[model samples]
Target: MQEATETTHSTAPQLAAPAAESSVRRTVLLAFVIILVALLGVFASRFSVSPRGAASPALLVATQPALAITAALAAMIVSLLIALTLAKPINAVVSLFALGCAFAAYAMQTGTISDFVFLGANFKLAALETIAWSVFIALAAIITFRVGGPLVDVPAHNRDGTFTGEIIHKRALMSLLAAVLAIPVLIFTMIGASKGQAIGACAIAGVLTSVIGRMIAPRAQPILLFAMPALVIGLAQLALAFATTISPDIAFVNATLSPIRVPMPMDIATGSLIGVAIGLGWSKGLVKHEPPSMHDE
Candidate 1:
């Protein structure tokens, strides 16, 4: 009887190990689902403005291409900032906030699609695009964080500090060159009508991302920076394609009047490149550093 009890007790932890792991996985999945639901809620809220409502010419003109583009860009930038900030610890509350911000960003970008009452089309492509973009960006950012390892927050320093200006200059210069070089590669890739622009863009983006990540968090690991960009740009292309096929009038609004829209290959290339630029640009900052080693004689 004692032997049997000992055996059961000894095996309990072994059995619990798998259960623990499964529980962790379940928790993570639940968190992700909650985040998705929050983002969906944000997208659905666009209807509060009554996308199906009619508007006067003045009202329509008031929300022109320029203002719309600016608003959309602002929303995306804000959401990205929030996401990067919240990504470090992966706390539930912060993650949910980041998810909301991300959805808001996509919602802003797709506002024109949703608010195109003039089109007279009942298609809910706008909401769908918003949802798709939000989910894509959120997942991409999370994956990037996971792959990149924990983000190290380094302190900022001016010239003559332990982190010399030279080092900063070097990293900055390298990242800038990478970004600059990416432009021509992107342009040529687009002009040649090559499908490899995505690859080229991703490569450049990765290099720049690493540089920026290290700068932001001195010990930050290398992550897939291009994923988010690729997803965003790819989805945009798909949305445009859908719009074009569904209704020429809708396509015209999106293609011609929408400042955010670009031509097929160029649009994809540009959107992705911009995403990379934003990632790199914002990442350029401070990071925590290890204390200097001591040398005792």
Candidate 2:
């Protein structure tokens, strides 16, 4: 009987794997379908875009589709890294915001911005942004079981149905809002079919990042959550600034980011400011978790 029970326990989990896989497969396929519908709209753009839209159209045209696609893939990896460092609500929101900004920037630069319409993912770089932005968002939503620091609190009802727990994050619905806002980015990620695979990879990576971040970040919250990530980002920005100053890449430089330029000192200051902001924000919502009196789960 003991041997039979052990074999049954092992088989039950294995049996469930295929069903879970199927569900995931279906979800990804649905996402692709949504992407395809948005791509079809790109063909409907009213603009009669000329072959030489700019003075040096040839030079602009010289860059390969491959390079653009590669940058996008790299951007996905960066997005994942950024997502990994983010707090649940903040992380997802930041990714969606970043991708949306990146998409808008790309559209404006390419002169493909349509003022009259809000057609989704009609411009270049939109699909990749969409996929990556949504990935982390989805993952954040899935892990509803949050395990944050002693700082954050989850809402719960008492045995007598009284509101017993402090819920600071209820108003901060990061995952849901992030996913909704990421729709356009998702469309852009697949606008170019060649990059479909990388975009998917980004989404998968983002989701994985969210899962890992959710588990790890909260545990490291009291110490490294704010400090470590901010420090690292500051260091990276400094490096990027130094590299660009020494040898600027016209394609790589962020036009809007120039205002807050870079360097170790500036980067460190910016990082310190960000850390301070996080510290202050979390502190304002600080709540203590007492031992549960009763559980119905």
Candidate 3:
């Protein structure tokens, strides 16, 4: 019995090591991915805004991009820490907030998908931007999968051939809420696009979304892993624009429009109320669905 027990113990680690290795690889890959997303934000800001460190007229893109990237990176890190650690309940609250901010930013900056309310975008991607988003989505899948941990669904042969409902895992849901902590980063994008104190407000919106989703169904984890860099750089750049009064005076026909706005931070009372709701009201909220397979979109 002693010898048999020893053999089983030895084999157990061997079984576990592969998953551990995969986890390490995922972490490294995600770190690199974080850097890449930040760089993209930097690049995006170079074209639209006249940043402080903007070098000579010709090579200005390189200098201006870094600050925007840095702010995004900061938001990404903090939000993740909050979600993965003590404040997991805030996920759902932030998710809705982020979802709203994303569409709002898109609306404020690029113009609506259509003049008519519910249709496709009037302005599609600039080819390169579309490609960049595609790459981001792929990276997001890797991040989401890593956070969710190992999956061991029933085998196809043992399972019915016909489709059945998803097999939900509690650990997966917890991991997802942890991951969705990166909420503030996306709100920055809304701030970047807005015309008033929308940046801080949008940043606050991010916090609110996490708070709300924490109340509702729990914002999906994938929302945090990718959306962070997307919004933060925009937020940073917008804040900078708002600070120095450097934004373009976009004209509608003749008169110039008002300058861009940063979002406001939520009041302490509101933040507390939302946080309490997220903490108490929807403790049982679950991530909506399992992420798509790694094979493709």
Candidate 4:
């Protein structure tokens, strides 16, 4: 019996090593696929935008809305194909968000949002364009999830432990906490006044939020966790914008509040989607495990 036990123990590491290596490889490949799709989407979307000129905000003024919309559609189609081929439908949805992020980051770098607000440009039209992008991307995500196979249920023990009776409320609270925790990180990273900062900030915020969020709410859906932060940030920005309309003094205060810099909606969405995927991949096996199931089938 002693020898039999020793033999089993000796083989266990050998079996586990290959599985661990395989998991790492899969994660790296997934990250690469997402990054590649995002780059492709950015390239496709930018092809339609006219080159920047000596005039300030010329890029925004020169861009034709119809052409830009067409570019966004083309980018989405390309990203969807690549994501479906390389990953799953859920990943395809993430890729679409990443594409939007890429576009928004570019816009931010070129001072599009600030120009819209301060330059007497048609801010409403710009806002409408953003809304259109969000609606279409969200619809795509919903459709993909619906068409994809149903999500596998986590074992009940893994989902809810000693506090089974209050698990619903606990999950909701933890999810909210996770979103709140992520807000500062997003704001800090995005407050920088440098070009191309939004993309990096979003990526950082997303990964950090997911890692911390998973620890607090292991049973929460990753997508839900990701979305909560973006939703919170987006709503906060909208509220601030509305406040600016109530009084010019409020607008001045908003402009001076460096810490409360407004990021494009797509920036938040992109960060949450891609960051969560990366975080979940990198933090696999690091989270605390629930007790082994007592009711074995």
- TM-score per candidate: 0.34, 0.25, 0.32, 0.60
lDDT of 2 by residue, 51-162 (tens): 3442111111213434444444444334334433333433323323333233222222232212101122111122222233234333332222132213243323233332
TM-score ranking, best first: 4, 1, 3, 2
Clashes of 1: 4
Q: In model 3, which regions exceed 4 Å deviation?
A: 50-201, 218-261, 264-297
Q: What do the candidate models score in CA lDDT, each in turn?
A: 0.39, 0.30, 0.31, 0.51
**Model 1 stretches with alpha carbons more than 4 Å out:** 1-86, 90-173, 191-297
Better of 1 and 2 by TM-score: 1
Task: Enumerate clash totals for all models, in the order shown.
Answer: 4, 11, 28, 0
Best by lDDT: 4
Overlapping backbone residue pairs in candidate 3 total 28
lDDT tens per residue, model 4, 1-297: 999999999999999999899778757755766577657655654543433431223223435746655655676666655554433524433444444444443344344335334544433333333344445544544444334322332223344333323233455346546656556776666665343565567667667766787676554444345455555555555455555454323443465633333444445555556666567666656676465435320
Model number with the top TM-score: 4
lDDT measured at residue 81 in model 3 versus the true structure, 0 to 100: 32
Q: Tell me the deviation in Å of residue 136 in model 3.
A: 13
The candidates, ranked best first by lDDT, are 4, 1, 3, 2
The lowest-lDDT stretch of 10 consecutive residues in candidate 1 is: 54-63
* Model 4 stretches with alpha carbons more than 4 Å out: 1-36, 47-62, 88-177, 245-261, 282-286, 291-297
Q: Candidate 1, residues 1-297: lDDT per residue as tens digits?
A: 999999999999999999899778756754664455446434433323333342211112222434433443454444444444444444322333344334333333232422343545333333233334434544544444553333344333232343224233433333333333333433444322122333344334434544454553343222223333334444544465466544635554454432222222212322443345344435545444655323100
